[model samples]
Target: MKIVAVLPPVVELPEPSPGYLFNVERAYNLHEYFASKGHEFVTLSDAKESLEPHLADMSIFICSPFYPAYLTKELINRSPNLELAVTAGIGSDHFDLEACAARNITVAEVTGSNVVSVAEHTVMQILILLRNFIGGHQQAVNGEWNLPKIGAYAHDLEGKTVGIFGFGRIGQRVAARLHPFDVKLIYNDPYRRKDLEAQLGVKYVSFNKLVETSDIITIHSPLTDKTDTLFNRDVLDRTKQGSYIVNTARGRIMDTAALVDSLKSGHLAGYAGDVWYPQPAAADHPWRTMPKQAMTIHYSGMTLEAQHRIEIGTKAILDNFFEGKAQKQEDLIVEDGEIVSPSYKIK
Candidate 1:
């Protein structure tokens, strides 16, 4: 069987750094894994250039969110032999699930692999933006002392209402971490978690109410038709004035221009997170220089600890497939011509 893996390019170093695990050339060590099994494997760091050439014969493809190889309908139809696509970590939105299902390609990801990492990162971002840490840090680094300038915006997380969108594993973890901060928590989800709501001291609220009341709003939902651009002009306009927004989830969930406008108009005091619409955001993406916006590259889920978990989970998925075992129910995003995860939708 022929297998291919796509990953981001990594800096060349003598010793394998923690980042080596993300490099297609060094990570997964497919060569060693296949040596005894006599399977053919190839790994590529460039999807546009390297992936298309191998599609005709490839039987399986592995990729990660950090360096996603988008499997569009066109690409899916080209790879007649493709039977499976595995994500090395969580979040498989890069692939075209509709096409995958139509072509009988099983799609899987490592569920619960990096929720803690992302949840922790989300809370950190909320604190950074709420306290105006970036303004203070920039002043310090630039050899300027403006206590008033920084202090003007900085505020305590206590006594504030925070709204969480999407009540999945990561969302629940985020609420748990924030419980000790003495802030009110409200959540909006398609399904209600009455038991968890009671346990976490969180309340369920309508999406509009959450927007109007939240001092800080964080996104934890998946990217689907219902959620894509969910925070567009209309939604952002509905948010409480001077509110803060943090998105550790997918970037496409929030409209880039809408977020920028919200910040510019002072409707939102700050915006911070590590997710972006395009994985390797262009140098000139609007958010890069948007005032009062704090954005980072998509690295929240790729921490050293998360990578370790991903490595194990990815190996398990591959092993199960090769050994003819059923894919874990939670990990099967798309299987047998349909999407099984409620978080994912056809759109």
Candidate 2:
């Protein structure tokens, strides 16, 4: 069987780095194992047009969240031999679940692979925005130390209301870490996690209420039909005035232009996150120079520790498939010609 691995373009290093475990050029050193079994392994960057030619014949395709080869229904139909799709990292939102189910394609992601990494990044972004860290740092670099101007917008996390948009693994972890900050936590999720609410000391609130009440709203939900552009113009208009936002979730969850407009109009105090729309963002993307943003490339989930966990999980999935064994239930997003996770269903 042929395996096609989709990843980001490799960085040029003067010498081979032993610790660069997740480079696309090396295929996470997967060739060593696959070659031993006489299986063909191919590597490609995430661009779909370049990957189109190989889709029909490749038996397995591996992808990562950092550089996704979006598996749409059209791409699924074109790939007649695609029996398995493996996500090297967490979150399989890039794969079209309905299409994979219809095509009898087994889709699995590395569950819990980057939850802690992302949760930590979420808290960092929250603090960066709330404390005006970006402006202060910039001022220092410019050789100006004006305390009043920087402190004008700075605020403490204590006694603030923070709303979590999803109560899943990463969201729950974020809440757990933030609990020590002495902030009131509220969450909005379709499925109420009652036990977790008690454990994390959070209140369950409606989506509208969460938006209206939260001083700092952090989104941790996946991008789905119900959540696509969830924080568009109408919703942003009704958000608490001068509120801060930290979205470590999918970029499409909030409208890009609407977010820029809100920041420009001073309706939002600040915004920070690592995710963005049309990632590997263009040189001229508005967010690059948008006022009061602390955005970074989508590398929060690609930390070295997270990469090692992802590699182990990915290898385990591939081993199960090659052995004709069942994959772990927790990691299976779509299996046996059905979408197993309600979070992925088309709403």
Candidate 3:
């Protein structure tokens, strides 16, 4: 059997670093393991290349959400021998799920592989914006120690109300980490988990209530039809004046234009996040120059530890597929033309 690992472009590591930015060390391991099993592994930097030459021999395709190789319906249909598609990390939005299911391609992701890593980054972004750390750091780097300018926007996280949208694995972990700060926690997930509410001491509130009351609103939801553009003009208009917003989820979750308008009008105190609507945002992306915005390339979930776990989990998923072992039902997104996960079904 032949497997093709489609990964993001290899980036030069920082000075004195021994690994590539995307970290292909695990891909090397998968190659060796699959080779020993008499399977061929061909790693490609991009998936745009026509697979007509190799599709007949390819059995499985491995991809990562960090640097996704979008598997469109046309590509899925072209791969005649493809049996399984494995997402190296969480989030399979790059895959055309309906197309894959129609073609009988089993799709699975390494669920919970990067939840802790992302949760930590979400908290970091929140602090970065709330405390005006970026502006302060920039001032220091420029050899200016103006306290008034820095202190003008800086605020304490303590005693503030934080609203979390989508109380999933990452969301719950974020709430747990923030609990020690003595901030009031409120959440708005479609289905409230009673156990989580009891354990985290988080209040379940309506979406509008969360927006109106939260001093800081952090999003940890998936990218689906319902969640796409979830934070639009109406939602932004309803938010408390000067409230900060953080989104570590998909960039499309918040309407970029609406967010920019709110920030321009001073309705929103700040906006910070790592993920973007289109990965590798264009040079003209508005968020690049938006005031009071702290944005970074989507790397929160691509930490070294998370990458290691992702590699292992992806390999295991592939191994199971080749051995005819069923994938963990919890990890299966689309199987045989049916949405196995309720999250996708309801959305």
Candidate 4:
């Protein structure tokens, strides 16, 4: 069997990080493992051009959700030997589910690997926006101490109404972490987790209420046909004035230009998240300079610690496959010619 990994490169490091599992060059030290199993293994950066040569014969394809090698139906058809597609990190939206199902390709992801990592990052982005930490940090970096300039924008996270969209593992964990901050927390999900309300200090609410009332609305929803561009101009226009949005979820969940308009008009206090449209954002992506934007390349789930867990999960899934054992139920997104995970609802 042949396994190929398409991963994001960490070229910024001058020297190799033995523990940095996802670096294109090292591939988390996976080669020796595959070779030990007498299977061919290959790895490359997430360059579409760099992946073409190996498409036809790789048995299992591994990629990270942070910047995936989009497994479209066309690509799936092209790779005749792709029996399995693996996501080294959480979320498998990058896969064309219907295509995988049709092709009888089993799709799996490291489901619980990055939940805690992403949940923690979501809380940090919330505090950053609420306290105007970016502006203050800017003043310090530029060697300027403008007390009024930064202080005027800073606000307390306490006593604010916080709304969370999509209360899944990451969303619920975020609410649990933020509970001690003494803020009112409300959430909107297709399925209301009423049992967790008291335990997490979160209440279920309608979608309109979540948007209209939240001072800081952090999106944790998956990208689906219904949710793509869900936060467009009309939705942004109706949000509470000065509200903030932090999306650690997929980028297309919010409309791109509509985000700029909201920030430019000062209707939004700030917008912060790591996810973006077009994984390697173009030099001219508007969000880079949008007012009060605090964005980064998608890495919230790629911390060193999270990467290690991802490595372990990916290996576990592969071991099961190599031995003809069933993949863990939670990790199986699509299997046996159907989409099996409750987390995904693609038609």
Candidate 5:
């Protein structure tokens, strides 16, 4: 079988120490593994345009959420031999699930691969925004240490209310990690688990209440039609003035314009997230110049450890596909034009 592995540009890193699992030179170790197993492997930097030449021969397509090669319905229909789509990490939203299901292309992801990494990043950003660490760090780097100017916006995490939207695996982990910080934690999710809420000491509040009362709001929800632009001007208007937001989930969850407007008007204290609406966001994207933001290139979930887990999980899914075995039912996002994940079901 022939496999085409599509990924972002190669990143050269300093040589790893002995015993390190990741070696910088041999990038995409999984590609090497599949090649050794007698399968033809082809790697491409950007499959969006380059994939056309290989679609006729490629049997399986592998991509990552960080640098997705969007598989449109037209593209899916064009690839007569394409059988499976594998996300190197969690979140299958990059692949149009409905389209994949309609075309009978099995969609799978490396679920839970980066939950800890992203949850930890959420906590880091929450503290960074809450304590105004970015401003303070900038002041120090500029060789200016004005105590009052730096201290004015900074505050202790204790006693402030923190609300998490979408109490999924990552959200639950964020709440559990913050429990030691002595801050009030609350969350909003459609299907509330009373036991888990009590265990985490997190209150299940309405979406409006969570937005209105939270001193810091973090998003960990998936992106769907219902959650697209979940945080707009109306939701921001309800937030406590000067509150911060940290989103490690899909970027489209928040309206970009509303976020910028709130930051400009001083309604929002700051915003931080590693996800962007368009992966490899356009050069002139608004978030690039948005004030009081600590955004990066959607790498929160691409840590070294995460890469290993995703590589292993992706290879396993491919093995199953090659052997004509069914995908784990729990791992199937869209199998045949029907939503299998309970989270996607209409209430």
Candidate 6:
């Protein structure tokens, strides 16, 4: 079976670096690994390039969530031989799961491949926003000492209310790491786990309450129909005034325009995260110029360690798929024309 990987252009490091494990040319070492097995493997550059040109005979489509080639219904239908859609890292949201299921295409990701990486990044962004790190850092770089400007927005994480919108692995990890910071933890999820609440010392709250109560709202939820633009104008209006937001989840989960508007209106004191919508985000994306933004490219999950874990998981999934063995239960998003993972449930 032919495998086509849609990844960003390779980073040509002039010198060797251990961190280049998942670059397009290296690709978690899949090219050499698969080549020895007599299977065809190819790598394409960038997310915007049309996959249609290469999809005609491809059986496996592998892509990273960091730079995705969105496989819509039309794109999915282009390849009758395409049986599997694989995420090199942990998010399969780039795939239209419903469309894949309708076409009996299996969608799977390297589950837990970068949960800790993302969780750590989320916490870092939270601190960056709450403590006014961006302002201070910019002042230092600009060769100015403006304590009043930076100190005005600087806040202590201690004794603050932090509400996590999704209580999944990444969210749980964030809560665990933040527990010692003495922040009051609250969360809202479709499924409530009594065990987590007891162990993590967190309480379940309604969606509205989560926004209204949290001094800092950190989003770790997946992008789904219900969560698409879930944090819109109305929700931003409900958020605690002067509160900060950190989203390591998909960018579409928040309204692009509303987020900027809130920051401009001072409703949200700051907004920070690494994820962005239509990534390879346009040069003129408003979020880039928005005040008090601590945003970065969507690469929190692409750490070298995470890339190694992803390599293991991706190899396992591909090995299973090619050998006609069963895929990992936790990794299967769609199978046999049905959505198997509960994480994608719209309601």
Q: How many Å off is the CA of 74 in candidate 6?
A: 0.7
RMSD of 1: 1.6
User: What are the Cα lDDT values of the candidates?
Assistant: 0.89, 0.88, 0.85, 0.89, 0.83, 0.90
TM-score head-to-head 1 vs 3, winner: 1
The candidate that wins on TM-score is 6
Tens digit of per-residue lDDT, candidate 6, span 203-281:
9999999999999999988888899999999999999999999999999999999999999999899999988988778
Deviation (Å) of 104 in candidate 6: 0.7
Q: In every candidate, how many clashes are there?
A: 0, 0, 0, 0, 0, 0
Q: How large is the C-alpha RMSD of every model relative to the true structure?
A: 1.6, 1.6, 1.9, 1.4, 2.2, 1.2
lDDT of 5 by residue, 224-274 (tens): 888989898898898999899999999999999999999999999999999
Q: How would you encode candidate 4's per-residue C-alpha lDDT over 28-135 as one tens digit per residue?
A: 668877989999888878548877888889889998878778888888899999999998888888889889999999999888899899999999999998888998
Candidate 1 C-alpha lDDT tens digits along 1-347: 99999887767678757544677666656667777789888888888898878989999999988678888899999999999999988888999998999988999999998999999999999999988899999998999998999999999999999999989999999999999999999999998999898799899999999988999999999888889999999999989888999998888999999889889989899999988878788899999999997788988888878888888888888889889999889989998998888789634
Colliding residue pairs in candidate 3: none
The runs of at least 3 residues in candidate 1 whose Cα sits more than 4 Å from the true structure, single-residue gaps closed, are 12-20
Quote each prediction's TM-score: 0.96, 0.96, 0.94, 0.97, 0.94, 0.97
User: Can you write out model 2's per-residue Cα lDDT over 144-232, one digit (the tens) per residue?
Assistant: 99999999989999999999998899999999999999999999998899988878989999999999999999998878899999899
> In angstroms, what RMSD does candidate 3 have relative to the true structure?
1.9
Determine which window of 10 residues in candidate 1 has minimal summed lDDT: 18-27
Candidate 6 matches the true fold with a TM-score of 0.97
- Candidate 1 is scored at a TM of 0.96
TM-score of model 2 (CA atoms): 0.96
